[model samples]
Target: MVLFLKRMLLASLLFLLAGCGQTAAPALPTKEKAMKVQIEINASVPNKQPTKLTLQRQDLVHKLYTTISALPVVTDPNRPCTMELGPRYTLIFTEADEKTLIEAEAQRYGCRPVIIQGERQQRDTNPEFWKLLDQVLREAAPPATVQKLALLHNGQTALIDSAQQAQALYDALIKLPPVPEGDPHQPEKQSAYQITFFTAHGTLSGTIDKQYARLEGNEQARGGSYYVNDAFMQQVQDISKSAHYAPGRPDALTVTVSGPEISMRSFIDTQSEDAPIMQQLYTKITRLPQKAASCSTEEEKRQKKLTTTSLHFTQWGLPLLSVEIYEGEHCQQVLPGPGSEVQPDDEFWNLLHKLNR
Candidate 1:
């Protein structure tokens, strides 16, 4: 009987060990999922300012929520902790409606608990909490400042080199709302100005017409034709008229597509169903930071059994700018035709591929 009891106890212990191995971490309790979160962060040291950010996108909020929810709860009532927290983050979460705002405070120091203030609960998930916060802040932060602004107006172009002016102009320009309905102040001859600015986000372009600059909602800026207040709009116009401005002209585009799935075709478009597409392609090509380079060894030997498209850009009587692209990642390049290799922004290459298809 003694032996049997001992065996029974051993089996029970084994079962409990297996169960413990499969146990998943419990998350902070919440009734509803959040689609957005607001975070405020600051350092414990002096002379620094706290920064506030609101993550409005759903995907980002969900990632942060997963980390927050997985935080292990602290059950010890009298846990010892260091006196001062090194870095602190106050996170406020309220997405789709619960009873009240849920706030969590994350601190760096001994016992490092992430406290959900309302529930009066603490979680021992500081390591992961800080790691995720670091990544999110880096991504959510915008470029420090605008360094250069390039404007294309009426076939004339100007490049603004003053960082201060570019920063001020772009900040103001991006905030203007779309022109309102039925207003009476129309300019006699309004010409559109195409402006491109360079930042950490890569090349971005927008258009300006008289007192309004039309900014398409792209990944960076909210899209709309924002009305540039008179004072600011006049400043841009005056800059365009300066001696630094240079004369230029728009180029015409011709696309020829020959592929297995499609017949030989060509477009000599300036103003038709294909005009906008051609114009956009031409504009993109002119700015591509492209040069000739060979493809990978494997790609070099791959059979060129795909469709080919060629674009020829012309300006009045100037020599034509010609390039050819294969339907697939062909050479992963746009060959400067008559020559075997050249580099074009893969983005531009992809755009043509979709259009040709």
Candidate 2:
């Protein structure tokens, strides 16, 4: 059940947004027919025995499946992991008739893999996913549930107060699989994001990096960096952006170009003759496909050098959001913040150039 307090006009609008012109999310399989999932655990922490479990809730299974499905896909077999084989688990998806649909070997300790049985080395699973599964396994045993929930990032504070929204967001979060790391020891100075949740009891939060690798902590926690992959953060971000935009779209957007070969200039406001073109440009940016979770300006000296452009979304002439884009060949991505980045489609660049002309 969705659980959290509700207040403020924006929260109210957020609820109405379900049917208020907001795009409907893809529907999940019917619970009664496909919610039955079998989970197997081997040598979990503090235990040496293997155990069997089942998940019948449509909502739970749906969240788990969808979350992992959203992670960045990779073809490489090698991933960064701590090599702790102590914790091993498997999840079996089946129909009401017990017909198996898919099987997954879940590891939160080592490679943090949620690999489909027999598949090559590829994983979208992360420690957070394993942690969530751990909680689910524990919950299936009996009872479980979190604290003041909020998304802390990029100089903004948005409280996840609604029960439905909070539950959905957290559910989406844990479903994200962990990424493989090269060193499992290479440490990033900062995580760039902290997603907190409201349990029925207190609270638990995760500090996340661009690769989606994370660490569990309380308020003001930092995360570990493993790889450079994100797109998942967009889910977390758009959730906040959706709620924030509920009151109104930004009054204006600014596109400023600054790179090794160009002088910095700004295109402010879009209410003139080229308004339609400007709107398309704005939409292209807002809907730009994300790549890395974030990029840290603090680590600029250590990051790969690149040429890029920047954009700023503002309301009443005040900055609301900002992003930097690298259109170069090295790592063409939209940088959302310190340590987080995203990939934009050709449309983004084409529109950018068109508008610039």
Candidate 3:
């Protein structure tokens, strides 16, 4: 099943280049045209993971539109001119002739223009689909969800009441999936699920007898289960016994749950500071749902890369729902903070209360 999806994705990408609007060649203007635009990103932000490209664009205006459309931060694509990413962030457009369309797009997306030295020569373009995706991801954060979140007033930085809000906003921004390219007719297919849920208790450790059977944590305070693979369960037991840590109260426990149906799994032990158990759980949960072919050469080395699966949770944190994804590895944890808002339009206090608790 996983191999079938991989083959389908490859085939869809080829069809996208030949037929779809995503990678179609730019329509040549009736008259001769020459414009040059170059987009350079810092790429290296401290303590941040590398951003992946999602889609490509040839024309500046279309590129901007494509970028906005691909953004995962924007919950409502139709919402007019919502800028939730950052204040100092600049969208540099080095066009020879003033292109009102692209500039208008920048303004609409809450991005500003910075003049750079270069000829606005028209060339083949593949806009950074990943960075734009990060922008749309901020919708779930506090500064975005709060009653009167700080709007971008002029200049490079937007003011917020606390650093936590900024970090939360960044977190939401970065967690978006890459913009998919290929034939829209052929639906995207996901490989197996390899999800890991971590906490502070290492109480339950054993190999399960079957695949898709529930593996529950032992302690009452830290009990949860998901349909997982038999081989994955064995691997967890082996890793746990080999792992050696100074035995105090277990500060963090991680459970590795893998299969075709697992999503993001996590256990927040308010009791402990270090979450080694949770770390191991994350490692397993992210890996179990993947196939051998999906593991990249690098991931094969560490044996801990997870596929790009959806992160769905059970209401009130019970019986979490797991979804499959394309084969890739990422580290994303979504633990509701103290004062975490239950709904999208709740007070910021809900977030504070959850994270602090």
Cα TM-score per model: 0.35, 0.31, 0.19
lDDT of 1 by residue, 114-137 (tens): 777755556776555666665555
Which wins on TM-score, candidate 1 or candidate 3? 1
| Winning candidate number (TM-score) | 1
Number of the top candidate by lDDT? 1
Cα miss at 93, model 2 (Å)? Answer: 1.1
lDDT of all predictions: 0.62, 0.56, 0.30
Which ten contiguous residues of candidate 2 have the minimum total lDDT? 217-226
Clashes of each: 2, 25, 53
Question: Which window of ten consecutive residues has the lowest lDDT sum in model 1?
Answer: 215-224
Would you give me the overall lDDT of model 2?
Answer: 0.56
Ranking the candidates on lDDT from highest down gives 1, 2, 3
* Candidate 2 Cα misplacement greater than 4 A, ranges: 1-33, 44-47, 142-357
lDDT of 2 by residue, 1-357 (tens): 134443566687766664332222333344345556787767654734566667777787776766555544444445455856566677787886788766767666665655675554445565567655654564354222433356655645456567766666555554465344334554456556555565653455555566554534221121222233456677666676755422223446666775555756666565655556666765666666656443343333245354566767643333446777665543456766776655677777787776566
Better of 1 and 2 by TM-score: 1
Over 4 Å off, model 3 = 1-92, 96-102, 105-182, 185-190, 193-357
